[model samples]
Target: MAIVTTIRRDAVTLPAAELGPDNPLPPLRPLDEMHRIEDRDKDDLPRDMARQIGYEPLRSLLPARVRDGYGRERAPRELDALVIENDRLRATVLPGLGGRVASLFHKPTGRELLYRNPVFQPACFALNGAWFSGGIEWNIGATGHTTLSCSPLHAARVTAPDGGEMLRLWEWERLRDLPFQVDLWLPEGSDFLYVGVRIRNPHDRPVPLYWWSNIAVPEECRVLAPAEEAYHFGYERRLRRVPVPSYDGIDRTYPAHGVHPADYFYEVPDGRRRWIAALDEDGEGLVQTSTDVLRGRKLFVWGTGTGGRRWQRWLTEPGTGGYCEIQAGLARTQLEHVRLEAESDVAWLEAYGPLSAEREGEWPGVVRAAEERLEACLPRERVEDAYAAWRPCADTEPDEVLAVGSGWGALEVLRTGDKLPGTPFEEVTLGDAQVPWLELLRSGSFPEPRRVGPPGETLVAPHWRDMLETAPARPLTEYHLGVAQWHAGDRAQAVRSWERALPLAPSQWPLLRCLAVADQEAGHHERAADRYAEAFDDLCRERRDDGETWTSVTAALGREALDALLAVGRTEDARSVWYRLHPVTRERGRFRLTEARLLLAEGDREAARAVFDDGFEVADLREGAGAIDELWARITDEPLPAHYDFRMRPAM
Candidate 1:
């Protein structure tokens, strides 16, 4: 049967909890998770590896806001999806959900190659929070999942290298302020799907670049990659070189062999063709390979442990099957960031399809068979040749725009007058968030908010910061300038800018919160607490039209204030903030956990225990976080309940 590939608009209705409005608060915390690399066998690492690790550590998420407003209460919501299909396969992509390839179906085998998430449950997994599991997720920002994890992407239909219509998703990543696009196409009647990714550094200065294409396959599969050794990074916060296929006296190829969550970053030799595969017992499954530019491949296993299983359940529905992730990145490890030269861009072509291998064959032999079979099925040259064919067409203007993402990209393009031919950030895509920045770009003046409320989103890129520094000194300008200064590592100047902005600010909460963060960073806990309290008070006093949404923001701010208050031994103040939260907000699992913490801090152990007795699930429970179990153990020297035990580390 002859096949013709096509793209169409679609929707998937899942029991999804909506991602409520992002917290207007700027992310002031320095990311310390990457710095926790254990000292075990530290001498084995490169001479300057640890020293270089300090470079490009995520300082703050200034332009992006934290997305913690989601709750556990899910309803059937229809998510906008884009579908691309041909004779042998069908792929469903959620453009609104970070352009996640939500499902890939193999027609001949009647199998789903990717772990299609049964539900869309936003968790605190992404960099800016609110990430869902499963499918192929593109991580473009530093070390963590991209801030766009639960956000939308601009999508359009473009002419493929093979003359078929391909789906392209593009966005301006605010973290590094780079524009990237992913072009996905399947040749007619071919089992393999080709993904061409390009990330451009539009500025004259060099920028740190990070990109990882994460593919989730069922846990029943045995993962394989051509590497004699792999770097094992665990929740123990250590990276150690371990022998591949025989780590810890077991064939670590299978995801089910372990009892703790971990990452096995395959040390694929310099000359090797980069690939990773996960095959079932019958040795038939998906294999992903890319051109040499993407040098790294990794297998992430959420092992058969309590915490891992709980996380699997939390991501989707409990009854659904669990899965593991096989990833490819530009750097050897996710912890590292590669440098993109000024005005240069990196492009790569990736191929995803099915492969068959000897099911019961020995360690290296089965992997070798899979490699040989893959070569016979779809040669590396074919992928390379496809990449060559797609290069010129990459700039082919979209014939039709299917979905619109944030206006930030359009704003950037307008400011810089970047002629990004193929991936156009059209003026029509600009919307509310980009309004003030647009005004700033059009006229030399940055407009202040018309009402006394939380400030809109902030942009801290060097260009925007330069503009803010030169703009007229108003509260909004000063506040934004302070943020840009802090992002630029001018700590003292940032503090001074906020101090100048606070008193005359229309709404004082934003500036006060920034000051609170600064004070906390400087080890002035009492001063931080005082400022947090003031910020929370000012927010509560405001009467706004966006009552429920404002309440959500207040709840988020209240949590931050409560933590600072607790740090200074102000339990009563923390209690006051907790009680001030709306009933709906207070009922959330996150707030319930906070309430329990406040109770414990107030010396009411039983009260905290009772809060736990009413079992609740923190929808945004962080990866490797076991706070519930710790709090439970504190109240009573009891074995942690199975449902509550979310520790991903070794039992030792």
Candidate 2:
């Protein structure tokens, strides 16, 4: 019933249109300029100027005209790519695109399971700024795609002892300065593709990290998972569970019904054999099963609204089709930082491919068919044997294996030091630096203020300074340095350090607030307003323009930015900023109260009263209820009541 077009894996190439001047990929930021931008302090600029500076490096720097119609007339050409295949499945890897699997085809069905973007269209989506929207983006070291997501990776094709070809892709995560590698193994006569990854923390200190496997699928698809409950990631890091697929008057499952888009983190109930799929209405899709190493799965849907469609267009070309992400995480959930010990390593195995289905909407039949195919071709037993045959780390043997069982999947080593008493695996040897750093992190003894002598003689330890100097130039390091400098009474240097750090870790509201407060304390009200405005923009981006209101440190900063702007007599700027904040922050009561106050300041009592009536609707959600009353009393020209604190705080 379905027409199929078979694409030869060998013939596929980077389309000529994608390579020419018209469709120019973002020119790589020069190393020196990148470093310079990384180290520059951005807190002093106005809000718009600061954003431009923050986002410019992430763009192609070409005029809009040049980038708009860049690849419209180009043709496909053969490129030097890594093609791995078997009798039933084929995958093409592009070493240039962070070794992403550019094309994955189910040979029998001739269906391209993974969404392959026709061009290397880098956009401002990733946390580190530049990101592409196709293929399986290997995200490690952070929540979003790593800084190198748009860059090339070190790749090599090697033959396993069993004579199977393996494509190895590796890159050093510049942000965390960690080494990570993913090995793609497609055994002969198999339809499923096995992926094995190892991430190593080569430092002597414990480092916080995250790992996510982001696989893109067609937009008009449903995410299938064996999840009974789903956690909705909300503003201010709020996570609450709702029934799977739908809850709280919201249908989270795709082909989403509501206007508000959703990002759901599903906790895989079956620890032994967890799997997830992205299938169409007819049950045709790709199924991914991972060993117990990957504990969490996430679904990101941008919905079919105008804004969502526009964002999808920005990510790819118009009519090229939009895609959603079915992601897997190493930790319980993304943004939940896991501490990796020094000189330590973690590895996991996963397999994915097309599911065979006989009828429309037959979820069970599709899953059964996929399992049968997996069993017939690359069974769990075969996977374990293959993984055990080729050990990943040459210098050491796995002392402890973390896996479900013999036939569940490949064994992974999550922890190395001591083997469980009844466990089957051997104890892994660890580097000498591992235990101390682990202990330090566990005891919360990292870079704390030290008492050098008697009372009031406290100062940041010299070792913290030493670590700051030698650590990778990352936001975390800069933050620690700023804290140390601030406590050491070097406020100006601390502000500068935090300013440099803010752009690197834009989502950190506390850091931004700290810089803002420092400027406010130093009598730089305009600079303080800029810092708060920048923080507000970061929060807006993090919330993805959907204005479901929740209170967080960033939300607090948004309120402060408004007050600071008004304090400096920048009424127009305050009004402009408030409009941008209102849609995303959605603090209806707070926005109304602010609007009323601004109107009253401009001698508009009737308008202020009208706003006050609207504010009363959501008064219960307002944090500064007393402040609202005070504003109301003032607009009515009434006398102030007994001592009242108008200082605002986040409604916890």
Candidate 3:
């Protein structure tokens, strides 16, 4: 049958909470930043591998601000979706949600190749925040889910490799200041969906790059890759080599066989085809294979543990069958970041489709049959050739615009005058957040706001920072420059910049928070607490609109402030800040944890115990967080409940 591809507009209405608005306050330092520099030497990794692991630590997320502004409160909302279909498959892409392939349905088989998350629940999972679970997600730029996980992407209908209509999703990744595009299309009568990805570094210097295609598959499936030994990274913050299928008497290849959440990065040997799959007992499931450049493949299991299950429930709704992630990336592990030389780019093609394991033996026979099926359906040569065919199409201008993403990309283009041919970040997309930065680029001066409010987003790219440094010496200029410096790992300089801005700032809270972070890092706990207290006070007293937007601000800032105050034995002060928080905010799992800490600090052990007894779930729990266990120990001698246990490592 002749191949025919078509792309059309569609809608998917799910119970999704509004992303509200981007938090104006830049997150100075966050907890996950500490994990970026894991003990590579301790892991006994090769020196070359260890160097890549610690290549470039993500010091601060300045250029892109924190996105913890969303809440659990949700309502039915229709989201813009783009559907691309061929004879054998149909892919429904959510252009509004990072161009996520919301559904990949195999027509003949009537099977969904990816985990179709039932609801849209925003959790603090992304690097910025507000990441939802589901479908095939394109993760780029450093570790964790991309900041764009919950944000929109620039999508358009473009010509495909086989003269079919293709859907193209493009975005300028803010973290690495790189432009990338994803081209998705289904060939004529082909069961596999082809995705071509490209990441470009348009700078004079080399940049650290990370890319991963995260496909969520049903938890019941057994994941198989091309390697026997895998790098195991558990919540204990340790990475060690271990056998694949069986680890500690459990066939961990089956997602639920593990006892806790962990990562198994398959060690695909050199010259071997890169692929990963999640199939059932009969060997029927999805298989993802990519060209050589995209080398790494992984299995991320949430495990069968109570905490893991609880987290699963927290992300969406209960009874929505559990899931585990099968991902492929540009490095051996997500911890390592490869260097993309100046003016260079990395591109590859990936094919995702169903596999039928016909052979009857054990692990080896099952995987071999699946591999043969994969080769029959979509040969490796065809994939490589399809990539060659798509290269030119990747640069083809979109025929029609389907959706628009953040204008941060356009602003960067304005500042640099760099012409991106296919992935154009049009100036028309420029919005409120990019306005001030626009002025800085055009007029060579960082303009102050008409009235005092939270600081807008910061720009930490070298070029943007240089502009800020040369711009007029206003407090606002110094403030953002300090943020850029802090992001660049210049702590002392960032402190000086914030201190200079403190005297004449329009909003003292933003500057105060940054300074407090510096103070805390310097072991000036008392000073840090005082600064945090003042910052929270400034925010509470400031004139604000009555909405969840500001409510998010207070909750975020208040939590940071409360932690600081409690660190210095200021339980009363912490309590006051906690009370000033919105009732809804106070009820959140994180804040509830804060409340327990407050009660304990004030010598009210019983009250603290009750806080835990109330039963709460921290939806945004860190991957390897031991806080719950530690806090539980502080309150009583009783064993921690299963639901609260997220310890990823075996007890020492």
**Among these predicted structures, which one has the highest TM-score?**
1
The TM-score of predicted model 2 comes to 0.55
lDDT of each: 0.86, 0.56, 0.85
- lDDT of model 1 at position 299: 91
Give the TM-scores of the predictions, in the order they appear.
0.97, 0.55, 0.95
Per-residue alpha-carbon lDDT of candidate 3 for residues 1-652, written as tens digits (9 for 90 to 100):
7547889898999988777666667877754732353573445886666878888857666577777656677889998899998888999999888889989999898999899988898887788777899899999877788888888899988889888788899998888889999999888888899999999989999999989999998888888887878988876767788986787888888888888888899999999888998887776889999999999999999887777887888777798799999999998888888899999989999999988765334667766777777888788999999999999888899999999988988998887898988899999999998999899888999999897667777888888899999999899899999988988889999999999988898678888998998999899999999999999898888837487567878887898889899888998889889889988888888888888999999999999999999888775666566788999999999999877876656677
When summed lDDT is taken over every stretch of 10 residues in candidate 2, the lowest stretch is 403-412
lDDT per residue (tens digit) for residues 532-596 in model 2 = 77666666555433321223223344667788887877777777666765453444455666777
Off by over 4 Å in 1: 30-43, 47-54
Give a tens-digit lDDT track for model 1, residues 1-652. Answer: 7679999999999998978878777887733343246445556776555544445768887678888888777999999999999998899999998999999999999999998888889988888888988999999988878899999999999999989999999999988899999999999989999999999999998888888999999989899898888888898888888998876688888899988889998989888778999989888889999999998899999889888898888788988799999999987788777788999999999999988887565767877887888899899899899999998888999999999998888898899887998998889989888898888877878998877767778889888988988889899999988988988889899999999987788788888888998999899999999999999888888836357568767877888898899878899999888878888778888888888888889899999999988888887777777678877888899788787878889865
| lDDT (Cα, 0-100) at 61 in candidate 1 | 76
Q: Which residue pairs come into collision in candidate 3?
A: 3-188
Quote the RMSD, in angstroms, for model 2.
17.1
Model 1 residue pairs with clashes: none
Global CA lDDT of candidate 1, please?
0.86
> In candidate 2, which residue ranges exceed 4 Å CA deviation?
1-80, 234-237, 248-251, 256-258, 358-378, 393-523, 527-652
Rank candidates by lDDT, best first: 1, 3, 2
